[model samples]
Target: MGRAPQKVRNRDTNPCIDEGDASLKCLDEHNYDKSCCSAHFQRYKNCRKYWHSVMLQRRGDGVRPDMPTAAERQELLDAIGGKPY
Candidate 1:
């Protein structure tokens, strides 16, 4: 018989903000100049965008929350076999 799947709970509490608001706050707190602020903001924005996109894709595609992709499976297989791919 198979074991029952585990239940996951939502744990995040921080409110979401747009890229502009986040960057402005980060710049104010860090006292960054225009160029430095822009660069830092861009980095944060890109990271957030990528994370959001991945989350959306996962939900839209109906992928199992814990399932690994082909590349990940291959890596695990290689690791178990003690061989480099």
Candidate 2:
């Protein structure tokens, strides 16, 4: 009988993004160094732009442009049968 084939271990292997060295020939063709091109390094610039938009919206204070006036506040209070303190 032929000997059984050895089982290969997959747990220790790193994915294409985490390898940190360009083992694939195609990345070398594009002059991209895996050590520098990992997604962790490239993600910050995209995230920063999104965060900047969120911060700008927060800085606008929660008031809408067509907000109500003091009369509206009194009407609301009267409807509830009480005035705001």
Candidate 3:
């Protein structure tokens, strides 16, 4: 039997994809050497940190499934790098 289809990584509208898409593509093409994509990890880390705080605030405010606005995502991407190719 064949394996299930793999989900696309770094897809559009994904939080860190704006800044990390190029790094992710390079890493995939180069066999995933961690050092080859440190920037991608860093951008994702920053995005995760911001989202953590956002989710915490949402929970305190009785909100469920906290999601970032497009502007919020763009800000994070700007802080890390430019828009995806």
Minimum summed lDDT over a 10-residue window in model 3 is located at 6-15
Candidate 2 total steric clashes: 0
Q: Ten-residue segment with the worst summed lDDT in candidate 1?
A: 8-17
For model 1, residues 1-85, the per-residue Cα lDDT tens digits are 8997643222231112344566777778778656657765776566456545655676789965533443554465477783221
Q: Report clashes for each candidate as comma-separated counts.
A: 0, 0, 0
Model 3 misplacement above 4 A? 1-14, 71-85
* 10-62 per-residue lDDT for model 3 (tens digits): 33324555456666786898798988788777776776676667667877888
CA displacement after TM-score superposition, residue 8 of candidate 3 (Å): 9.1
- Global lDDT scores for all candidate models: 0.52, 0.42, 0.65
Model 1, C-alpha of 18: deviation from truth (Å): 17
Number of the top candidate by lDDT? 3
The CA lDDT at 69 in model 2 is: 37
Q: After superposition, how far is residue 67 of candidate 2 from its true place, in Å?
A: 24
- Which sections of candidate 1 miss by over 4 Å? 1-35, 64-85
Ranking by lDDT: 3, 1, 2
TM for candidate 2 is 0.27
